[model samples]
Target: MFSATLRSRAASSASLQSRSLATAAAPSSSSSGEPLTHYRITLRRSAIALPMNIKGTLAALGIHRRLQTVFHRHTPDIAGKILTIKELVTVENVPESAVRTKWEQRQERKASRGYEVAGSKLGAEP
Candidate 1:
């Protein structure tokens, strides 16, 4: 058990080191020398209930029901669509890497909790 814990700690440290290196290596700005800003848009609600025109806008932004898409830099077209369906998309300005990592962590936590609940329910069923 001690060896297993040590191995897990080592692996976790290695992963974090690699992530930091990758982030450090990333270019800080675009070709135009402007700071590359990115936004993470998560579709919390389904836009299927909306009309075709609004749905088209959502699709154009690469957002579907319960999906998330990250856009680099703010474009007028994107901003317009976001404004049009402000209620459907939850937008946040964050580094793309950070956004992805945060979503993955959230998913992992949710999955672990779901499995724990399911396991407890099964054990009680008998």
Candidate 2:
């Protein structure tokens, strides 16, 4: 039973890695003629309310808030912090010039003239 469980866990881990690799390989566009490499540091999981010492460690590497900042390259110091918060983040690399997806940047426009957004689907037949 134990052996079967371990095998299943290993397979799950391998599948996750494969999916991550696919996301990392998504194409990105470049405008400038300069060569550059890009990386994406995604905060997969986080331990909220970090201890003071841990906060200092993260501050030392310029990361303060959770799920913030997309840096360019992988630095040793950053890698170390990542190790410290290994449970909190998942770092990946992507093209530097990659554009944000349209849906990601779409914000709900506020209603004008005192109109409020009802908590209902727009254009639903009532």
Candidate 3:
């Protein structure tokens, strides 16, 4: 019984991956000279209450929290994982230059202060 279930899940994931890749490849191939090399995947929905396999797939993609974003090179394996939990996440094709590290993502999320400091308080001769 367990083997049958696993086979069905694998089949579904494979089919979904093919369909998604076909659709995704169409526009990029015709639209630009530069190819998109990375996938910007964001966890839009929580995996809570979902099947353990679904949660595991998300973990495999390096997404542990809702709204978290991770970048991965465009590959068949990654595409399969994305398709498995397609409803729980959002995917975008990005150029290699757009890929950012975890620290870079955090830095981009931070807001800049409105004013710049002319001098530090410690610089004053009291």
Candidate 4:
């Protein structure tokens, strides 16, 4: 049992290290060297049974559903809202280019059609 726990911890740490390295390589930024300017906030937990103000805060942040992500500029107001519900979400600093609208996010979630029909066999001359 002890060995199992150690293995899991080691695996998680290794994954964290890899993730950090990946972010370090190609930062999401423009050629002009603009710094990360947005907060990519994803709701990781639901506000069910929580206080009304907490729920209100979530709504103010435009987060209505669990696992829903919202991007907002780095403003004091947004940061305060995030801090209020810090335990319920994950925040990442992202460049402006990384922000996506609802439609774009939905489009990305769709699986691409792997095969495209070029020409019908019957339409082609044998």
Compose the digit string of candidate 2's lDDT tens values, residues 56-115: 765664565666544536567666776787666665555455423334424323344577
**Quality of model 2 by C-alpha lDDT:** 0.58
On lDDT, the stronger of 1 and 2 is: 1
Candidate 4 on 10-123: residue-level lDDT in tens? 977776777755433334422247688888899999999999999999999999999999999999999999999999998877888889999999999999899888877886
lDDT tens per residue, model 1, 1-126: 999999989977776776645433344421245344565677878876679988898788776557665454567777787888788767755444444444665575574443334344554756
Error of 1 at 41 (Å): 0.4
Instruction: List lDDT for all candidates, in order.
Output: 0.64, 0.58, 0.86, 0.86
Q: What is the C-alpha lDDT profile of model 3 across 22-76, one tens digit per residue?
A: 5465446434567788888999999999999999999999999999999999899
Stretches of model 2 off by over 4 angstroms after superposition: 1-17, 20-36, 99-126
Model 4, residue pairs in steric clash: none
Score candidate 3 by lDDT: 0.86
**TM-score head-to-head 1 vs 2, winner:** 1
Candidate 1 overall lDDT versus native? 0.64
Deviation of model 1 at 57, angstroms: 0.7
- TM-scores for every candidate against the unseen true structure: 0.46, 0.43, 0.66, 0.68
State which candidate, 2 or 3, has the greater TM-score: 3
- How much is the lDDT of residue 73 in candidate 1? 52
**Which regions in candidate 1 have their CA more than 4 angstroms from the true location?**
1-36, 96-126
Give the clash total for candidate 4. 0
